[model samples]
Target: MRIGLLTDGGYPYATGESRLWCDRLVRGLPQHEFDLFALSRSADQEQRGWVRLPDRIGRVRTAPLWAPHEEDTRHPGRTRRPQGRIATGLGRAYGRRDRRRFTAHVTALVESVCAGPEAGPGPGEPDRAADLFTAGLYGLAELAQERGGLHTALRSEATVRIVESACRAPGTGRTVHSATVPDYLAFAAGLERALRPLSLDWYDDDALGAVDLCHAASGGAAALPGLLAKRFFGVPLLVTEHGVPLRAHYLAVPETPLSAPVRALLANFHGLLASEVYRQAALVTPGNTHVRRWQERFGADRDKLRTVYPGMEAERFAAVGEGEDGGGPGTLVWIGRIEPAKDLIALLHAFAEVRRDEPGARLRIFGAPVQGGEGETYLARCRALVAQLFPEEGTDAQAAGDHPVTFEEIGGAEVPDLAQAYAAGGVVVLSSVVEGFPISLVEAMFCGRATVSTDVGAVVEVVGGTGLVVPPRNPRALADACLALLRDPERRARLGAAARARALELFTVEQNLAAFRGIYLDLVGQAPARWTAPPDARHPAGRPRPFATPPEAHVLGDLIREPAVPGAARVPSWAVGAEGVCAGARGAGDGDA
Candidate 1:
């Protein structure tokens, strides 16, 4: 089965949030062919280039949401009617009642955009154009909600009138006043770009129509394509959101210059979009419970929700604690991106107390900053803290090393791979003030090292009794936990052993692959049969079905393929479909339903 994998600002892009996890999933599941449809956030990200994809990936298509093309392309030559051409056309499309509403709404929205501070909408006059846009947009959204979807002839005069009415409505924000004729035109252009999926060219049989399932690597605009796939081709969409895009938008919009009304409108738009995505998705897989809760709040069904932790390769840490030359018994290593969120200030303060108590303790801070410009500032501050804490740097330095607190990059001296960072210490420490499932802690467990982690995000869930837990920002508590682990060699060994066992059992690539393998079959099995196109729907790089004939339809061809022969073949009749080949319809209800 061909899988349409959609992602926004991730996967394929070199700089992205979940690129690594997406890459791992695709590589681990080689039996399935994947087509990547990615949306890059910025031109800088696109210029940085993508990770080299494996041969199993069939095709790649990308678009940039950060910077859309400036040139406006109208829908060919059409006669201009009253209320300026666009409004009349929209009016006719939306019918009499909706026609007036959509025109008024869109006009106000366009005016607000034209009036934007960047365009000349000044700070005093909130961009009413934005509000107008919101009114028109949501009006259309409400229409879609009422009618199941927008009609194909939606760009008529009625639509424009509905938009125009919304812009000129009373009690509306003042930003609408700043919207000039050109601003409205420009706003309309931007809206079209954002709503491009509504009129995408890929929904036909040649594209998503042939796929067995559409798996959105992440939601929001990345999933928009999948939404279109389901809408146009009847394909089932499986949306996987590791980090909720709506939450990110909430975090980001406050920093923008848009008026409160504009912000609220945009937020509502995103909220509505999220709800729609959840509604259309066959299943929603959130990487952790935090994300799962976010989905539920946005109205996703609990039954449709599944939490699948992103898997990591754990074999690299196989030699730790369980081996003869493992780490010394009293070191604590903090490994991960050196961002302020990692709370290095808190870690430094906690380490000071840990040092005073142990007298011979060492903390190895490994990892470079992931954020580009601001990272250097955080790194400098952390280094200064370390210098102040252990001012000298000899046996007066703290431990036996050149520096009691060493900050080194992975692939540098002392630390080579991530596994080596964990192995350098008997106890791994995480003093993050904020985090998302500390991947470093999981690596430490894989290395058979005990850990002391602050309670935040999925730290408690992931650690699962395998490590000591402490409150974030409490320096004394962190120190006490570290001291307890450092003082007990037996307890450390036991916890480390258990952590490794747990990691082996739950977090390995093998287990992740197994879970997804089952999920893929289960989801597709329950999905409605959507692929109704003829065999010509196949892509140029298609695979042939070797055993498409049913057992009842064939005599010589399937005679040898009947029941069970012996040994492994006789072990189970239900396991025959494990290879994803064409199976008989004796139990085809699973996929057909």
Candidate 2:
């Protein structure tokens, strides 16, 4: 099968979210061919280049999602026009009629976004606003497909005017009505970028249209191309979300400098986009139940939702797990990117309490701060808190000294790697206030270390009775859980063993690959065959078929040959029934037959 793997700022890239799992999936499944359609978020990301691809990956097509410069107008894959016929500016891209159509569509879209959920009438009447948004969205996509692209139209002054009008329109939200000219302009630019996938050349028959299935690695912008492919070529879309994009957008809105109105508008757009993606997708695979609930609340059909846990390479931690001795029984380890969401403040406070109870207990924090200044700022704050909490212990912020609390990274002298880091602690702790999938917790599980994590995101689901779970933001509960694990070596060892068993059963790359392999076959089996004979061919074109030809059918020799056995009775091919042949193909022995 030919799979079009759609991704944004990830997969095929050397660094990004969802890269490892995607790489693992592709490598594990060598039977299916893959065509990667990646949307790079920044110039730096693209410059870093892609990871080493497998032999099965047939083609790689990438486009920049970042703001394009003047030179980018004539980027490769853009449809060529006659020299004199080319558009020179935003205004010249459309005629008077096209401009009117664009105005109507953009107005409808913005108006729908501006009007809050309350705009929808009671049950019987349906949500007119939602219908308008969907119509406007697809209408713009169709226009972009017919015209060269919507880049010019979406970024034009007319679009700003449409947004402004929608903001000021009667019955719109109060926040939306407060939108200034600058806000309108900002939103117009953002909208243009968000909808940029509509103008991509990937929809052509030779690109996404040629693939058997469109698998979106994550939702939002990544899945936009898959939506277009499904709309254009009847391709089935499979959307997988490790972290819900809408939830991320909501969390990030306050962090941006944009006005409330602009933020609100963008949020609405993302919410609508997520709904559409969910509605259109043949299947929506959320990484955990936490993500699944978000999808369900956003309009994904429960029947279509499947929870597929992210696959990890358990082999790396195998040595650590199988070792006789676990790490120091009194030590608690915290691993993950140092960010505010991880709530290191709470963890530090909780550790202070732990110190009061058990003076010999040590806390090792092993991770580097994430990309922004925020992480550095949070790390500084945490360090300050640590000093204040353990003033009498003589702490060293960079290394483990006589102090009970130590801040360190994974690659330093003591902790050489991830496995070793987990091996250095008896109890792995996750104090994140917000999380999608607790990857660090899973890693600790693979390392055969008991965990005490805050009950957030998929923590409880991932832990699954193997480890202790505490309420988020509760220093007392967190401290108690850690103490419970630290005080009882028997319980810790038992939980560690159970965690390793669960991790081995549910979270390995082998199980993940098998799940997807089966899903791909099932989806393809249900879908009608897309193959058609050419007009000049011997067979009639567009003849309906029951199912697409399986890849195994192309092999020259018999797929299943019965092994010969001494004194075994050979059944004549004509005498054998269809069920007998099927049973034989399923490895039924000659004696059983």
Candidate 3:
């Protein structure tokens, strides 16, 4: 079975979140063929080039959400609709048929969003907002297929009018009802962007229509194509969200100026889209419980949710984990990208307290910030804060290496790469006030080092009480925890050993791959298989079944029919001590309904 793997702002691109995970997943599963459809977030991401793809990837298609829409070449002599030609010929223009359909669909969508899920009897469908949204979305998609594209149709004065009518519709929310003509225009523009996937030419039988399953890397615009594939081709969709895109939308500062009412309407629209995606998805995999809770609150079925922890390679730290030295006796190390959310300022203050108490203790900061210009500003501020917190040092106070707080990247003289960074510290400390998965904490665990991390995001869940936990932004508590580990070599050794054991047990690439492999097989098995196009003709197979028989009807041709005589067949792979492998309908860590 082939998979239509969909991703937004990541995968294939050299720079972005989850590229490594997507690369690993595709490479790990060789039995299934993958068709990658990636949406680049920026021109920079596109220019950076793609990661080298493997043989298992059957095809690759990409588009830029950041770029202007390319001209549609599907129809001959069909140029961009001329301006002021609205009354030319409802036939030559968006057919009177498709236009009416478009108006009905757009009306239903905006009304549902404005009136909210509590709105009664929406567009002759169920009271559920998801149903109403899906109905409207697919209706518009069908119209786009008949017409050239929705580039002009969605952004036209007609759409603006529909939005205004919906905003002022009966039972609408006060905020939506109070929208102005300009507000309607702003909202319509956003809808066009969000609904851009409908105008793409990738929904035919040669494209997503042929896939067995649509596996979305994340939700939001990334999953839009997958939703359409499921709607038009009956493909089962499996959506995996490392970070809930809906939450990201709500948290992100708007790039363009917009009114509060416009923001609220846009948020509601996205929420409705997310709910619809979840409603149609066969499974929803959340990276952590935090994201899973968000999905559940957004109406994702609890039974469909699977908690798949992001996998990391442990081989890089294996040698250091088993090395002779158990790291420095009086050092605490912090690793990961440097950003404001990391709260390096708090770590510097905490390290100052540890320096006063331990006297000889040192804090080595390792790893660069996330790619972009924000890192330089944040890094400079952190450096200044470090200087303010810790003054005089050995011999040369001007030299950064001589200071108690040494900031360095992954590659340095004493600490080269993540393994050496972990090896340079007896205890690993994470001071982030905001984090997604606390991957740095997991990396420390893999290196067989005791960790002291702030209680943020997935730290507590991933730590599972194997390491010391402290409150975020609390310098004294962080200092106390680091001091306890720094002073007691025996306790540090014990916790480090246990931490490494737990990491090996639950968070290895092998376990992660096994779980997903099972999920792929299960999803493929559940997806309905497609037969040949027409009953009268063959699908042009190398060895066609019979001229009379349909593709679905097949005899036992070369498949071995005889059962094993005694101990003839080898044990199935899943039955051979693969205790962590996901099996049957219930995968590993699938939440009970």
TM-score of 3: 0.84
Clashing pairs for model 3 are none
lDDT ranking, best first:
2, 3, 1
Worst 10 residues of 1 by lDDT: 79-88
How high is the lDDT of residue 268 in model 3? 90
In the range 70-164, model 2's lDDT, one tens digit per residue, is 33334564543321121223357578876777787888888888986658668688777788888888888877777767878888888888888
Best by lDDT: 2
**What local lDDT does model 1 show for residue 281?**
93
**Per-residue lDDT of candidate 3, residues 1-593 (tens digit):** 46789988898888867899998998888766688888777656777888998887877877666524434233444443321111112234666677788788988887777776466454656656666677789888877766656767777888899888888877778878889998999888888778877777778777787676789999988899998898886778999998888987886737447887798889999988888888889999998898888899887999999999888899998988834343468878888888888998888888888888888988888878766788988998988777677655642653647677777777766666778888887888999887777788888899888899999888888888689999999999999999998888888888888898888887888887898887876765556644433333222322211112221222222112233576576332333343423322222111111
Indicate whether candidate 2 or candidate 3 has the larger lDDT: 2
Candidate that scores best on TM-score: 2
- Candidate 3 achieves a global lDDT of 0.76
The better-scoring model by lDDT among 1 and 2 is 2
List the candidates' TM-scores in order.
0.73, 0.88, 0.84
Computed on alpha carbons, the lDDT of every model, listed in order, comes to: 0.67, 0.81, 0.76
Candidate 1 structure, TM-score to reference: 0.73
